[model samples]
Target chain A: MLYTPHLTTRKIMPEMQEFPMLSLSSRITPEHLFYIRNHFPYPIIDMRTWGLQINGLVNRPLYLRYHDLLQMHQVSIPVTLECAGEKRALFVPKTRGEQWELGASSHAVWTGVRLMDILKAACILPNAMEVTFEGMDKGVRTDMQGIFTYMRSLPIKEALNPDLLIALYMNGKPLPFRHGYPARLIVPGWYGMASVKWLQRITIIDQPFKGPFQAVDYVYVNTAKPVETIRLNSTIAQPSDQQVLAKGEHLLLGTAISGDSPVLFVEVSFDNGMTWQPASWLDPHESYSWRRWCLKWTATNSGTYDISVRATDAAGNVQPEIADWNEKGYGYNAIQKIRVYVD
Target chain B: MLYTPHLTTRKIMPEMQEFPMLSLSSRITPEHLFYIRNHFPYPIIDMRTWGLQINGLVNRPLYLRYHDLLQMHQVSIPVTLECAGEKRALFVPKTRGEQWELGASSHAVWTGVRLMDILKAACILPNAMEVTFEGMDKGVRTDMQGIFTYMRSLPIKEALNPDLLIALYMNGKPLPFRHGYPARLIVPGWYGMASVKWLQRITIIDQPFKGPFQAVDYVYVNTAKPVETIRLNSTIAQPSDQQVLAKGEHLLLGTAISGDSPVLFVEVSFDNGMTWQPASWLDPHESYSWRRWCLKWTATNSGTYDISVRATDAAGNVQPEIADWNEKGYGYNAIQKIRVYVD
Candidate 1:
């Protein structure tokens, strides 16, 4: 197993861990450091017997072995996956969940065959309106009856996106045991919940999937609407909150990302939102990946300052001043506020 | 004026500001860097006409010049003053006020004559029940009908504490304009609110004083009882929240303080409160002033950690796991929890 002692473990039963935002200084997160989110304990998978099953609404029912998929055309791309509940602890009134602060998201290179490529081989029928992906992991839920597998669905239009991948490799290395050893799904531009791990079967359906994860858990409690695409967000990586520094030049660094489009630009405010200045981009704009930005701040005087950062995506979505708070605490994309003292 | 550009500004009219927690590493905070909490605009004072008035229930009402009090027995001691509303923003229900995070407190050397010494010379009448301190600054209150000066009171028994002073100097220098010029009352061991500034009068009352500041604002909203002594509290000064450090031997530092007694010991927890280890004291035990503490933390593995610190006072009061929730958010003495990442 790769060295992964750095991830912060939020739960031990289902094995949920988070990536540290300070590690965002690196363009692509190391596979071992990438966050892991699971619904149930790791399912015992025998590589020799593991197979990918594709059926329902398809002319050809295909069940291919792991070696058979490895022989298919493989594509590698960098993508960012953010948990819907990232920054859930920041919500007022206290939401229920893992209470992740701001590290429930990470970026990495995923390599695998495009799910569309597999669907084309299966010859999807015209009547397929949505496709459901189910993981082998199953457990009993207090809110539901009997045992249920971790399952989620995507609309046919989203499912057909060529960017969606049946990922087999992370950061150019075989998937680690804790991060779905055999295989996992990678739905770019969407929350991590859509990328089901411990992949087992895919079925095309004529209607939306209403499993507990898709219907009750991940949905915004106030609206009862399922969360999907990642929201525009930015977080400071330098001058950690309440840090003190000597009066001098300091680099204010942070990262920004959006699922819909590349971050167009980032702006920072030092006077509590009174004035904003453009920050220099550290990394070239890349779709489906976090963009690092920084500003050279020279402190001529000593004082405590509430530094804030906001990002605007190419699609014109700017991080809001105050996020629309929901009971489940999904999609918290408010401007990042960090307080620092310079002496 | 000593150069003080480091204080964080919370309001402008009355000039409320906070000293950064990172600057707490030093035992004695500089006069200019000390937090400034004011209710009304600074009241202009002419040193020539300024005189402390001792009247009401006193047997011999007396008006003494500043120089006259200076000639009396004078003493200097280091004391820490914390605003009752410090960490008010951490309240879950969200209280209504300045919304100070944690910088609204600091330590300074105060030099002045004891309030008990003045009360003795003035011959307080046996019927005196309380002492009312009134500041020169005045403003119209939305809750009240007419203009009102900032005022508060202390029971006669507590008012006689020899440590309480009508301070004239801070950090070995005459009080600065913003701190309170000429003279100000310093009720050691009490919240900063009771240490009335811009002192203009001291009236010994025959009954409990019911000024707005005493009976309305500083009191807990749910209980309606006034907040008095500072709560036992501790704060991490190093490895600030979300800070990323290289994996190695590092020193964890922090400061703890209490109003009732000196901090007896401090403990650090790295395993999320499961087990705690003692932290070495960096400063000699000093009552009414913060005690600095540090621990050697060697990180053998890279991982995200929720480092927590808790302090126990000599009076046998230990910091609580969770502070009692109050509407106004006063006396937040919960154990300090800070998250950091090691890579």
Candidate 2:
């Protein structure tokens, strides 16, 4: 089915577009408005001939048609997928890559068969250490020679997690071409990069995967470790930076999310953090989805005010005042500061 | 002479306004456009009754009229005065303060009597260790009870610096009321906080002065030291962040400044600092004023580009990729990053 894209384009060649956060009022984002992060143009696919191949270090090397996965038991869940370099432009040194602001993130309910069920049927070998997923998209990287396909790997234990799914549908509809048509791997609670789209092959390997996307691009250059869980973060949707408003009551809006835990609270500061007041949660707490929040603010004085917001997760992760800098500019989750004027 | 204020008001109570940097073309800012950093409302003064009292540790107590200062030899020099809180909003942890961006700075040629000459006339005693300058503006601070006047002190050595001036004229005209009317202290090479405005008293002390502006404010909270010299910095004036443009040659404009030393070079990075190219200097180097620089860039691809700028001083101080985080958010001279799009 064809649909009009609702994302704001940041890049044209590879077609990278981000969701408009100001338009978000619901926990589940519309499928069309879901942010699109692509490394290459959508790979042409003939759904009639498509098949999923599960091989390497397994008892049964199975090649099953797309219809076979639909026949298996399915699970549905709402998950937030945020780009690893979501706020790359805000980094101090400005790392090289897509200069995404705070929009390269979105949430949606996905429905598909659990990967654990499929992996059990394949009968993984005892020596297997990782599961590598490969997509059909190919591209030339300036850092490396020759054309290469997008690929990534996850630990054996993580691959078998109950929440991991080979998603076939998004928001109760067949996945669109831009988001991977026949099937895609959905690794919840992790960055979008870990969930390989346009997925065609899965290999259970005996050792770690060394593909550039897995070992180089997605890894924090300063620490040489792959970025995993999402950091505790909050974004202000109202009274944007340098916005002028009338001196009276105003509603402040934002969203907070974490990867492994639910948000405990979100705080808003009007006096440059001298004091913080709790913001009311607008949405029910969900383990894998962002919670919308709002605060009623009254500005009696006419002047410029510095407004800041911070969030804390149930796992004791408080949004930092300053995130650690990385060369790739991944995972910047510092408290948000927006300066506005009351006139 | 009445002139229209060309500044952008940041605060209206204490009358704080900032220069519109995009309107800057010359090294010296117009008197009406120079940024104003005030702690309190402008104090009313009668020229017939106004006198500068120089006493305390001096062997001779002297009160000089405004004309008395004009009788002394006058020295003129261009100086750049930057607020300590400039760029406070850019701090990662989100500092508490005015939330000033890059506009809280300006350059001007000041004509006045040398502060050293005035001190010589006052005859400093051997016990003098520090010299304090006090302003007439008074206000009540939330951090401290009761009323307090804006005051700051300089070391005896720095007080004797030949470059320091009792400025009476700014940009070839009598100092405007918004800027310090009759006479003001100009602490060259130091942050603007040290330059007491509406000068009414000067005291030489045997030890350090512990006024709030000296002991508490105008300090790096993390270091507990008074912020002094300005940091090497640069600001982009053209093709602002998130600005969209046609895919063609465009001129990138900006200014670089330093306190004690001249800016040696300014570099622009197109590939997230992987490589940097030198920008052509447009203004001649001045000891205490910002120099304008520009680069002609051609965007061949239709995509977002992360353009960054960094300035290096002759003193070997290079702008940092990440400035050290401070509670008061002083001295943030990190390299600037502006994302622009070509379509």
Candidate 3:
């Protein structure tokens, strides 16, 4: 293990031990600490030889040197980079695997050259609808498993969002090596995995990149059905589970986002899965991003009760009770159930 | 200085260094990543010798040891812990002091006991409108300066919120020595200063505590001649200042919170003090907590434009163009203005 600082150990306060919490913001200082999940040793990139390649469904398969790319137009965007499995801490039965208890997500002010600028330079064909990002880091699994290249894809529209950029700086400084340095993707408001670090290549295609990383790995399918379908899920960040409440009113708070659609309404339940109440939501105009929501919960009854919350998106999709089981945990948006006692 | 990792230097590719950017998340990790603004160093706390004293305007002045306090009703709350000067990075030249650049906030699942439960244990009396918190940290600025003790007070209503907790654990573990071992106030969604670490005493008063920290420091006053009154202001977390933009449509995002009032609307302007548009808002219920907002803009014209965003509270309070100045940088919510250039 690397020389983990005392701060990293101190970061996990006793009050937060039960759940895995990942800092989501990118303004990393003493207060905005970083919890890193490294699959392999940190890679060192020599800027002298580093270059970016754009190929596949483009008019020109160009190999631009790093200096040449910098000569192009530069753009900065303030976007939220979240981990797709942010609320993995709320998972009950303590699912086995890379034990990630919250703290896997963060937001950042990414400054970089926009990918759209590069695509426009390459003259993207109208038939291109999928964009794939390949990173320099190699995926490491079990000993028997061969090392595979790490990559993920996004819809061309999302890839073309002016907010999306090839990030180079973090919090007004150069990107940390542990984070994707030199250049990485800044897909605001999406899961961390979607923002590929150690970026090497960008490919445009007509269809989704149904590779092992996207198809068998991160994708989730229901356990009960013959047809594999993705399940919607949401989580509550405030008013944590098993919390003891005073005999008064309080605010139940957290954020919700959907993979397939935009969040329309979020409902909170003070009594397990019984009576439900509506939570006030912040509108984002776009349906793909996450929405923050809160509900006024008055603790009239002074006793132990389970507080549960679920969310529905504009596509008439509500968070399910259980997420479909997959080889790799992805799309685990189930009904988040928390226990709280009122005194 | 501590072992500030040279992670960014070696890892960043040379091609990506031209743009300066920062991540949106305040803290990236729990320990070394989170910023600690201590009025004083770590206090040596002995649970056996440590005791909590609750007095003033109450039916009974109760003195309880750590063990005794633990035996009392326990409460846990998942709240976002923010520092008053979180966005110091965005502070313009006229408002530079403590110089904290956006690394002064965090959120955690805090678990422990409630102060209200103890107050209920010691029968409450009428006329209790304010509750004051005192810590063990003491300091004297330079030499010969008067000794100042860190103390703050909250409204009786805010103190009694079921979400408020006397946290003993963070992220679900014992408190670290640096982070007020034994006990501390977890005022979810408020600035970190409000959640005084190294808690020592609690006192109920008939009126708000008018101390230096409360009345003089951390308080914002207008900068106008014969300055008008002090009020709430707005802030953006993503775009600090001088960020680059691509020549296309992009979303401008950040979070804002009003003191003691719910944010009614957030407006964004791209042409420096000219026309403004409403930014999308999230969860408008908790006036005391922060709200995230975003606005979409098309950068068809390629030039540097001053992007300014202001927020209005439900009480009809709007962020000013020129925030009132003070000795310390409190309430520096001058209509936050940033410069972004389109190709």
Candidate 4:
């Protein structure tokens, strides 16, 4: 009989768990192992009266009750979600916010109504340039100065892509409570922050949305484009980082994925960029799911060794060696390094 | 005393040697190890009479002698070059062509006059969509029905980018006879095929080129755009692929780079995608140079293991877990997979 690795969840306030890179055996990361990222504690609401409103610069404002969406045309897509700060624990000198590793990302089948259809039904006014989303998960926080509801927006064009959705189900079932029970916005290609949970209201505006989350919080320094794409990335899982092993042969395991395009190749180096060998895929890859790969290494001498991995995506983007340090340490995709001792 | 890895160059007809991934220690790969990929044998010509002519759909056809270009305003930039089939050997079912492994690529500092400057001097006529380059290395081939000179083109806009150059020197010295002696086209972000060597003429045309190199060969099936950017990629040199290592402390060595962007993170997997460990950088990275990284692995057991490496560029492009196989095997950037048995 084969043995399956168990999920690893760490104890934290808003609730978080670092997905062990080893359990990444399947394409769609099971909902149980999916990492959870929340700005505030989960808020529970009565499903009966929970409604999503769309107003502002719209010819016909929409007031959609959760039930109305269920009656509309439905669609599903395998989408991957990542927090603005996924692997922040690896950041040196430390940065503020959740110290997540690769556990901050996961893939699931999202079933919902097309966001474009909703925008069209609202009859977007001519001058509308952005569509904003407001979630029922409201709260006062140290960072978001005033009373605020978790909100975010999309450019008019991006909102029109048929792929974007106001999701009502996750992994073939009703949305999980911790994952926004009634409905949630699923911005396919962007980070998780843009996917407002517990969706409540949406607004179309001509000027850029200046709410705290949009105007300041999610950005790094003055870089306006808030950690949008999941940077070309990979994570090593087996022969656990810094683990002591007996001198012999062992297998190296890990996962790699990108948001902009498909991944092309992954190479492993044991001598500091001197020479690299390729890794084999363990599972078929989907655009949104992280790719699993492995390599066979024969360790002869008993001592400490340094190993490295680098990946390049189909769009021809190469992972950088050093990440540009940001105060909040969002989007930490720098090449990972580690040391292990041998007996 | 420390052991320094030596560069490896395989013997072949057009005179080829796989760049020892180990000796890839510097930003500009040393001259000797740069992969040698020539369509035809070197063509010798008197430098005094060598002139670059600009004609076809142009208001003014200009002819500039070699000496004139040497005296004109010039610029030097670090650019990387890669043959269309750089990693062809890695393709499955083995496609037709050189069957190159990874040595079909190299980095160099090119000194030349900006291609934009020369194009402006030609006074381009209206409706010029493409700019073509003709080289002096004329020869007859099985692919070309008759005798033909190597030529390639760029969309007018790409030709005007100041970064594109009419290179006269490589790595602070006159271009080597075997490496496009007098002058050559240096297309900074494109594959090596676009940089026609031993240049002679420049022509602007309104219609798409139907040349044998562009239409029949250098392409995947009937697609038009000949492999442009080098897909984000990396290679390991030290501890050569499939090398037997003594079970002890060792540093995994390798290099990663991208033609279109700077590399981001690189990770090493010791158990496929199930686990990964970060690798450390051994040298500072530059835009065009492959980055050097090292990771420490402690081999505690004896068995066969597959080690894999993956990289991401700053643009957020991740190395794909697989490569789309092409008939000519051009631009193959599949994640490198290697097997090593540790004793």
Candidate 5:
């Protein structure tokens, strides 16, 4: 038999220090772990040349260098960072791409100044319906041709939440090179993709930013329908990636969140998508981030078993058994099914 | 002025190596990063004396040594382990407790022998309604006088899930001392409290295990009520414990799950509980585990602000703005509000 540690006693060495935590525990420490995601290579910004241009739908166009931004009202807030597709690697059914085993999310304490403060300095415009942010990352998708720059936009109303900011430090320290240093945007409760790194410009426009990063990519579509529709989805993040288990009774634990509404409950199935049982909630702190839940199950037979999990939000949204597959594989929140073995 | 990183570039580290995706990117390797949650010191068992006794309401009492369990049908399953209060520390109300900043959860490839196989060997009695598990950890709570052994119980139907097991190893290795070693219960889709570490005995009973661990200790009650009522709640895991942020447009992201039903949606409020907005779902995967979601907000003012998040499940279960407070802090899914600042 392949010997493996039980769930309560597994020991794994971490690759990096400063594992992020909401509080602290013996099992998880600050130095041993935490996941990191970067959209652009760390930009080597010359503080002298780093200037933020706020124009477009605004009444005033202002150019604020790094020094100018520093001179503005400085603020710090505790916020969380989540990848748009943190669990996408696990949702790829039969397809091999960036196979992330559910470890793409994290939290941190950000310290910086608010974007609204800078925008206010430039006077608000009347027709501003959306706010667009441009980053310094320069890359192109294999299927696309242009040297695509990473950019994201949000409704102007969302741009006014008091938690948003332009960060320069993390965890009470200078931003690391791997993490966007010098400057970055912090969208307190949105996906990490919306929080553009190496931020350079903020444009207030009457319409949403129709950039490659926004309209072309990161959008989910129905696999059975046309590619124009965008739907919502969620993912699980607790069970390790590619985990092998000797099943009897096991707790299914992870997190879930939604776009249209607040997550209500999480469901689990052990009988190859046959029966699903509601998992218990550990904490449903917010609708914007993942909620933690757990299900208890016992392994009765010995065979390769398929286990699947899905979620529903308060808005009556249930995770589809199969997400509409889009060409870019944007929103793949289909029922996440895993194959395990009983002795 | 404080400078925080952009929410887009900020990354949330997964709780464990098994979980590798975030709102934006995936962790590069499993070894360097991963989350871990340990309940007690790992125990070493002598196979000769370390026998599992199945008694109580069973038709036949059976005492099987560790070796005997190995001889029985062995099982393995991939599961996730999470602390009930992994993100409690981030609550802005400043509850009196060990503030966990997140990372009190983890996923692992667990290998173990099936519990049902042994239960069948003992011949379960017809009147059995619950199964109780006993572990080696013993402690005394301020409310209780005598030294109490750690134990928990599950309904007979839940104990019969085909994925549950008696985990012996984790991540393809012997159980670590910090985690439950020798043997432990792997109750899939439940909180870590249910998966008793250092397991020593299994008892079948017609009554629920009303021990301190179940009734008084690991339970939650509405503080406003008589503290006897049980209330449900949820948590977000992505932004991660005390994440400092800069003021501007940002995304608040995390995962949530529930025990009674599937998570429906997550909501966020930046103005100290003045208004609420729904977060976007990144993946609608398993409801038993975690669901990923995010909220987009732009900081308009610069000051210490309270950000709150709440969740609702498919069954119309909304995380209460205030949960009943129990003596033992369980079910703390009240609207988790965080205090952040913009410059």
Candidate 6:
């Protein structure tokens, strides 16, 4: 059993737990404290019998055993995986899903085989528009009563991006039984939903895949644009939500990661978003890894304030002061607002 | 005799007018077009007859002619003088006083000897608690009717600070007739109230000065804290109030001045104050000089917006999101909001 007493657990069926402020604790989250978000209980698997099936819109419908897949190639890549409903607690009228605060995200170094190499070996058809991944774990969702496996799809070009990986190990060790054991798909720049765990099947489709998680669950139907990549964001660690401190000099620590664009600069505002100061970087910049940052703040007055943090990416995308709200409360990256009392 | 066609001249007796946004024209405001905020008609005087009398609690009561005062060692320093009621027009319910907008302040080079030297020469008496200055000009009041001069005072220590000066020159030339021709008192880091024009007499007293400008007029009785030194502030210049422009990349220029502190950073928010971008500097930094800054904004969407600009100073004072309201609309330095249409 993973010892993660610090993380806030919102539910047990899906086994959702949040990561603590890593900038305050450790730069690389240990496997035990790493956040776990599962749609179903850990599936029992035997490496000898476990195999991945690649069909539909492929020149060759190929089936590769787990051991054979691992023998092809191996590389290590650090990636941050965030739940679609990362900050769902911010929604008004109370969103119906897991009401997460600041957890539901984690970073890990995965030793894996290139997903691009497998797709090339399977000879993906030219007509393929999308690629769908199916997990081995199955369960009946509370929202819809039906035996189903968690599934998601990505654009064909994104699915074949060299950044994609099929990992057989976590943090240098063979993958843990609960973390897919034999192998799992690792989609670099998409939400954790696209990184299907307990992976077993892959399908190339000529049109958008209508999986439950794709069509009915994660999409923000109310908004004009559907939710996809995680919005650029950063959060304060030392002054947790509703924390208190004496008026004096203090250091604020946090971490930030943007999906498609590299995190350019992270700003911390002591007085909401009225004025902001750039937080100094604690870690060298990286695309998929969360950058650790901290800023020295001299709290001059004693009053309540919404200490906020927002990030801007190289792509000119500013973390909107207030992220647009959705019914399911998906990508709620409105400047990570933490109210605190300075006395 | 000075040509300033764009200034809104409110009265002929007092000669009250405002400077146009010079960021759209020039950086250092031309002496001729500098905003004129007179409480009374400009006082005419012969240089030989103009003598500054030092009396009351001073160790030696002395009178120095204008020529004798100019003979003292002098230094040039940049100081921004902002009227206490700079942007009073923004107040609702129509606060009394000039319904001025964002043009009542300007920066200038003041050449003079430090007021500290004069105090040292006369040997300020220990009993003195405040030092008062009375301008030569006089007028009848609208709020409190009675013949009165534009007089104000400050604490003895503040009045004798090395930064305080009796300026004899404006922009390297002898002061213009309308701007206190022979000499004027410059109280750095305080509102224009402390910088009395057409200086005539200085009285060091054992109490806080209680002239109409000091007691009944300038003070905001409605608020717990009396309105004082110009609040930390900034204002947009290029995109004039309620101006319209095509949807494209536009540069916004502005200026910010603080009383006791140096302007540190200025921020501009197009969508009210929800989001802000750091504006770039146009000139070298100078204490007391209104900094010239502009930011390149690509207006992608077409709509009306209240473009806002707020500034912070090195002393850690942030321009309040909203200025405190008062009956007289004094020290209106809230985030300068300008509504504009983009088509």
Each model's total of backbone clashes:
5, 1, 80, 130, 226, 1
What digit string (tens of lDDT, one per residue) describes model 3 on residues B1-343? Answer: 2223211110011100000112333322343233455655445567767887888988888887777766767766555545565444344433433334334544455678887787777676789988998888776532224777788888888788776778787767776655666788877656667888878899999986876667755665444221111235555654434444456787676766654566788898877767988988754445234556777777787666778889887788888777445534554567877665555
- Candidate 2: tens digits of C-alpha lDDT, residues A104-143: 8998888998999989999999999999999988887645
Lowest summed lDDT over 10 consecutive residues: which window, candidate 3 chain A?
A10-19
Name the best candidate (by lDDT). 2
Superior by lDDT: candidate 2 or candidate 6: 2
Report the error of model 6 at residue A210, Å. Answer: 0.6
lDDT: the better of candidates 4 and 5? 4
**What TM-score would you report for chain A in candidate 4?**
0.91
lDDT (0 to 1) per candidate: 0.81, 0.83, 0.60, 0.75, 0.59, 0.76
Tens digits of lDDT, candidate 5, A79-185? 54555544443343422223233444555667788877777877888788989888877664534456766788888887887668888777777765445666788
lDDT tens per residue, model 4, A206-228: 98888888877788763655767
B232-334 per-residue lDDT for model 4 (tens digits): 8877655545444546576777777788878887788877767766777876767656677777776656656678888878888878888878766787776
Q: Residue pairs in steric clash, candidate 2?
A: A321-B93
TM-score of the second chain of model 6 compared to its true counterpart? 0.93
Lowest-sum lDDT 10-residue window in model 4 chain A: A1-10
Write candidate 5's Cα lDDT for B1-343 as tens digits.
1121111101122112123223223211131223443333334466567777789887789887767766767666655566665544334443333334334555566778888777877889889999999987665453446777778888888788777888877777776544566777888777777887778899998876789767765555444321211233444443332233345687676656665576778888767668878888876455344556777777766555567788887878888776545433444567775544444
Candidate 2, residues B1-343, lDDT tens digits: the string is 0112235445554666667666666778887678888888678899989999999989888898998988989999888899988887688867656657668999899999999998999899999999999999998774556889999999999999999999999998998877897899998778899888999999999999999898888788888877999888999977666655666699998898888678999999999999999999999987777889999998877877989999988888889999879866899999998887675
Off by over 4 Å in 2: A1-343, B1-6
* Candidate 5 or 2, higher TM-score: 2
Which segments of candidate 3 are over 4 A away from where they belong? A1-37, A56-59, A65-71, A75-78, A89-94, A124-131, A143-145, A154-163, A169-174, A188-190, A204-212, A221-232, A282-289, B1-343
Worst 10 residues of 1 chain A by lDDT: A1-10
Q: Would you give me the overall lDDT of model 5?
A: 0.59
The segments of candidate 5 whose C-alpha lies over 4 angstroms from its true place after superposition are A1-40, A63-80, A86-97, A109-111, A139-148, A171-173, A220-249, A296-304, B1-343
In Å, residue B113's CA in model 2 sits off its true spot by 0.9
On a 0 to 100 scale, what is the lDDT of residue A73 in model 3? 77
